[model samples]
Target chain A: MIPTIKNSKWLPLCDVPVLDPSSWRQVIVQNVREGDRIAALFGCTHNASVPVRLYALLARDGQGTLSVLCTDVEKDYPSLTPECPQAHWFEREIFEQWNIIPQGHQWLKPIRFHAPYASSTKTSPPIGEADFFQLLGNEIHEVAVGPVHAGVIEPGHFRFQCHGEDVYHLEISLGYQHRAIEHSLIGGPNKRTLPYMETLAGDTTVGHTTAYCQLVESLAGCTVSSPLLRLRAIALECERLANHIGDLGALAGDVGFLPTASFCGRIRGDFLNLTAELCGSRLGRGFIRPGGVAFELDTSAFHGICERLTSVSHDARSAIDLLWNTASVVARFENTGTLSQAAARDLGLVGLAARASGVKIDVRKDFPCGAYADEPFPVQWGEKGDVYSRAYLRWLEILQSIHFIIDKQERFVPNAVQTQIGNLQPSSLAVSLVEGWRGEICHVGLTDDQGKFAHYKIIDPSFHNWFGLAMAMRNQLISDFPLCNKSFNLSYCGHDL
Target chain B: MIKSLWTRLKQHHRTIAFPKQEPRLPEKFRGLPSIVQSRCPKHCSECVTSCPTDAITMKDKQPHWDLGRCLFCPECSRACPHGAVLFTDDYRMATRTRDNLVIGPKEYGLAQPLEDQRRKLFGKSFKLRVVSAGGCNGCEVETNVLETIVFDIGRFGIGVVASPRHADGLIITGPVTHNMKSALEKTYRAVPDPKVVIAVGACAISGGPYIDSPVANNGVGNLLSVDLYIPGCPPHPLTILDGLLRLLGRRYSTSRR
Candidate 1:
C-alpha cells in the first residue's frame, strides 16, 4: 500500500521527500507497473542555480488517492522511458523545458519548440522544424499536413509515413499555438491568472477553471458550500455536454451522416446557450472563481434552467439517436482506428479515450472531490477502443451528465455562492483534478513563503492522451484520418500549453 | 430513414431571423459597455486598476476604454462605484478603423462597410481563411459555429474556404504567437489582391489576456492592415455575424435592447 493524498488537497512542500535519481526511477517504474497511472510528471526550479526538482503524481484509481514522489536532478538523469513506456512524453517534455538530458530517451525532440528555461529565447529553433521518425523503404512515402489546416481549427503539423493507403506511422509536431501559459503563472495568481485558466483550453472554460479554482481554494484552506459546489459541477457538466454533443455531430459529419450532424450542430448551441443564460458567456467564462462560483442560480433562474435542460435533453436524444439507428454510420465507426485495451493502459491514457478502451479511470468516481464527493456518477466505459466505442461512450456520458445535472439541481439550496479567498498557506502544494469533458484535468499549485505561486502546472487531458491518438493511427487507413482524428478531438493549444 | 426525417422535423427552423428580426440574447450576456464619464468620482481609477489586460487607462484623469483590448469580463463593471461603466447587450461593437475602437463618452460609429471599391469586389461572395495562430479555440469555435444551422453564415455568401488561394481575405484569431507569426504572414500573402483582414476576439485585436507576454505579439493589427475588429474575449457568434454583415454593407436591424 502506498501513502497518498485526496484530490484537491494540499500538503507542506517539504513533506514531499526528495529521492536519488535511481530510486526515483525505480519507484515510478514499479508503481506504474502495478497499474497506477501518472497523473502529472514535471520539473520545477526556482532559479537556474537550483537543480530541477522532478515531481511525479501517480493516481491510484482503485484506492481513490494520488501518490506523490520527488527527485532532484542537476543536469542529467537516466531515462524512465525504457522501463515505463508511459513516461515517454513526460521525459521528452522535461528534456525540452529544463535541458536536463534524459540520457537514454530513445527519441529526444522539442515538444513545444520553445527555448530551454536556462537558455536564451533567441537560440530556440523554429516551430515544426524537428526530426521525425522515418521508415526507409521503396514504397514508404511521407505526407505532411498543417500548422495551417484547411478548416477553422488550431494549427499543428502532422507527418505520416504511408505505404499506399495504409498509415505506417504518424508523427505529430505541435507548438504552433503555445502562448507560454504555465510559464506566465509563476510568482503570482493575479487577475491575469483566472482569465489564463479560463482560456487555457477555450472549449473547456468551466472544466479547467474549476480545476484552477479548486486548487486555489484548497491552498487557501477554504470550503465551498454544497450548493455552490453543485453549481460549479453544473457549469462543468454543461461544458461537457456542449463539446461532447458537438464532437458527436462532427464525427457524424465525417461519416457523411447529415441528419445527426446538422441536428447536433444546432443542438450543441442550445447547451452552450444554457450555460450563457447562467454565466453571461456562451463558454461559461465568468461563472467560476476561487472561493466559489461567481454567480448563483435563484429559484426562478433555477426553474428556467431546468425547463431549458428538459427541452434540450429531448432534442439531443432525437438528434443523437439517429446515429445509432443508421447502419451506414454505425458500420463506418466500428473498429476504425482501434486501440487495444493493453495499449491504452500502457500509454496511461485518460478520459473518454481511456474509458473507450475499458480503462476505469474517472477522476469523479476514483478521486471524488467538490460536488462529485457528495454525489458520484457511475463510471461509464467501453470494451473495444474503436471509433464506435469512443462515439458510443460519449452518448452514454452525455446521458449520465444530463441526469446528474438535473439531480443535483433538484437538491440545490439557496445560499451565499461565493466567499473571499484569503492568502494561501505558505510553502504548500495542492493538486486538483477535474474530469473534464475530455478526461482528467490536473492542476498542481505550489505556494511560496509569501503565499504567492512558486509554480503552477496544468496537465490538460490532451497531454496524456495525444500519444494514444498517434498509436491508434498505426496500420490505419490514411483516408480515415479525419474520422479517427475527430473521435479523439484532442486540443492543440491545450497540448502546446 | 423515417427516424432521420422525424428527427429533422423535430429540430425545425433553428436559424435566427437576424437583421430582419433581432435574436433574443440572454439578459446576462455581456456585450458593449456604455461609459458614463460624468458619473465617475474625482481621481477614481477603479476600472483601470481592476482591468486585467489594462484595456482601461486613465487619460487626463478620466477612464478611457480600448474595445480592442477588452475581454468584457465583469471586473470593470463591478469595480465602478458610480455605475459609470455598464455593459449593455449591444453586440454590434465591431469597428472598421483601429482609432474607432478606443471609446470615450460619446457613441462611436459601428463598423463601416469597406471602401466602395473593396465592397464591390467582395459584396456578393466572400471567402476567408481563418488562421488560429495561438487562440484557445474560443474564437475559432464561435467562428465555426456561424456555419451551423442557427447562424448559417453561408446564407450571407460568407464562407471559410480550405485554402488561402481560394479566399478573398483572411479572418485571424489568437494573439499571434512568435511561432505562428511567419505562418500568418505567409497565409496573408497567399491571398490575391484587394483582400480584407478581419481580426476577431480580443486576442487577435490586442492580445486579450496574453498581452505583453514575451511569446505573443499584441495582435494582427501590428503585423497587417486589419479592416474590421470584433471585440470580446471570444466574440459571440452573433457579434461575429453582425460584424461580417455590417462590413459587406448588408442591411441589418440595429435595435438591440
Candidate 2:
C-alpha cells in the first residue's frame, strides 16, 4: 500500500485511490482541471512509459480545489498550459516520446536524448516537426560546441544563441553519450541484468544500482537484510563523498587553482582507492546485487579503511584550509551563477544542486532510507545558490558523509549480516527515491509478463537540473561555463543511458 | 607563510624510487585479474556475468580474462557469491605476452624481470592522460591516485595531463562505449604521432564485461594501437605507476626502498 505521509497541495489531487495496474492513472479527464483559477503547468514523462499526464493545479473554487484554466481540452476538460508556463518541458518531453498532443503548449521539443523515440511504423506514424527547439532567432549566430570537448569531459553539444560573450537564449544539445542501457536490461534474468544497470554511468554506479535494486525490492515487496541496507547506504555515501571531492577539486581547477585542484583530485583519488580496498571496485560497481550485497566488510578491512580515510581527511582538510585562505581560489568561485532558492524550486532543481541554491531537500533526510533512516546527521545547505555556494556545500556534505561512514563502519560487527531475503519475487509497482550525490534519484519499476521488469524509469536529478544549468549559464560569461557546469556535475551517460 | 613551509617540508622527504623499487598496494586494490584456480567454483558463471564490459570470457570452460580488456573491478570476485572468481593480492601480472595478459588458471605466471624492465623504463619521464569510456570508474580512480604523495608517479616521470596533445601516452580506462570510441579516436588523433597509448584496466583492454553489449566497442586496439596495457578494474595505483614508469623506458624493479 502507498502510505500517505501528509496531505500536500498536489498529492491528494493526483493520488489514485488504489494503484492497481489498470489504475496507473489517478485523475480522469474531469480531474485535470479544477475550476476558474488557472494553476501552474509542470512537466511530464513518456514512452517506454505507461501513462501520459497533463499535470496542472486546479483552482480552489466551487470545488474547493486548486483551479486552473485550460483553453484546449483533449476530452472535454479545459487545457492547462495557458495557466502554467513550467509545463512546457513536460509537454514537449511527452510529445517527443508518447506523441500526446498538448493542445496549447509552446516550444515542444526533445528533452532526454535527441532521438526519434523509437522505430516508427507507417500506421502509428512518426512525429516530425521543423527543428523542434528550432525557435528561429533574428540575426542570431549559432555557435556549436562539443560532441568531444577540451577538458576531461563527457560528450555534449551546447548550441548557444549568443551575441558576443554573453549567452542570450542557450540551447543544450546532449545525448552524444547515449549507451541505451535501459533497453538492454529487458531480456536478461534479474541478477544478470543488474551489472549492466550498475554501469549506466560509472560514477553513478552505486547510486543508480541502489535505486534500481531498491525499486525491485519495493516492487517485489521484499525486505532486504538490515546489514545489506546499511552497507548499501555506506557504500553509496562513500561514492557520494568521492564524487563530491573530485568535482570540488575540478571546479577549483577550472577556476585556475591547479595546486588546489591537484590536491583535491589526489585526495579524491585516495578515497576511490579506499573504495577499492573495502569493496573491491573503486567506484562501488559490484557493491550492489539485486536481492542484497554479495560481500561483507571484514573488521580488519573496515579498520584499515577508517585509518586511510582519516589520513586522507586530514591531508584534505589542511589543503582545503590552504585553498580557503588562498586568495586566487576563493576569488574564482564567488558570486558566479547565482540561482536563488525560489528560482531553483520553480525550475524543479534537486539534490545538492537545489540545496546549494538554498532549497534543502535530501531524500536521505526527507525520505530517509538505509542508515540515514536511523542517523541524525545535519544536512548541509547553502543560500547563495551560486558556484561558490554549491562548491562550499559540497565540501561540507563531504565532511558529513565521511562522518557517517566512520560512524556506520564503527558500529558494524563481523557476522552481523546474517541472511538474504530468500525470495526476490518481482514487485507489483514501486517508487524508490534516494538522495544521490547529484540530487534526488527517483526510480519507478513495474513487473512484466513473466514477472520480470516490464518498465523501469529513472529520473536522475540532472535530468530536471540540466535546464537549470542552462538557466544558470544565462547572462554569464563564456569563461565561467565549465565552472557553472561543474557545479551541477550532471552525468551525461546516466542521463543519456 | 608558516603553512607553506610545513607543506614544503612535507614535500621535501617524499622521495620514492619506483622504478628502482616497488611500493605497497592497498587491500582492495583493483589490479590486473589473475584467475586463482583454488578459488574458482569451477561451475559458477557469476564473474562472467558481473562484468559490465565483458572483459572476461570463458574459454574451454575455464575463464579467459583478457588483461587488455579487463576493467579490474573485482566485480567478478564481489559478484562471486560462491567466491569463485577472486582478486589475489599479487599485483605483479605484467608480462610480454599479450596473450599472457588474459590471465586465468592457465595464465597466472609472472613472466617479466622487474629490475631490468625498471631500468629500461626509468630511461626517461613521460606524461599521460587517462580517459574512461564506459568503465564503472574503478580504473579512473586508480589512475587519479598515481600522483598521491606516497607512490608519486612523478618520481618515475609519469604525470597525468588533462589534454591528449600534451600527453606522451594515453592511459585509456573503461569498457569502450560507443560514445567514447570517437572521443578516444579523437584524443588519440590529437596526440602527436609516436605517442604511445596505454589501455589501463580490464575494461579498456577488452571491454571488461561490457564488450558484447550493444554499447561497447570491443577493444582499445580495435580503434587505436596501444603500446602497453595495464589490467585491473582499477589496477593497483603502484602497479599503474609502475606500468607508466616501465613505459617511460624504466625497468620494473621489485626492490623495496
lDDT per model vs. reference: 0.89, 0.62
- Cα lDDT tens digits for candidate 1, B82-184: 8888888888888888778888755676887888998998999999999998979999999999999889988999999999999999999999999999999
lDDT of 1 by residue, A205-318 (tens): 999999998898988889888789888888888999999999999999999988788888898999999999887999998889888877667867877888899899999998
- Which numbered prediction scores highest in TM-score against the true structure? 1
lDDT per residue for candidate 2 within B1-257, as digits (tens), equals: 67655654442444455545555555555555555667776677888887655667887778887666555554567677766565666676555346767666563533343334433543465776666666555465566656656566666556777777887667776666765666667777887756767777666666655656665665576787666666765466666655555554455454334
lDDT of 2 by residue, A230-301 (tens): 788878878888899888778877888765676776677677767666566667756676667756777887
Candidate 1: lDDT of A243?
96
Q: After superposing the true interface residues, what Cα RMSD does each candidate give? A: 0.9, 4.3
Candidate 1 — which residues are off by over 4 angstroms? A1-3, A47-49, B36-39, B252-257
| TM-score of every model versus the real structure | 0.98, 0.79
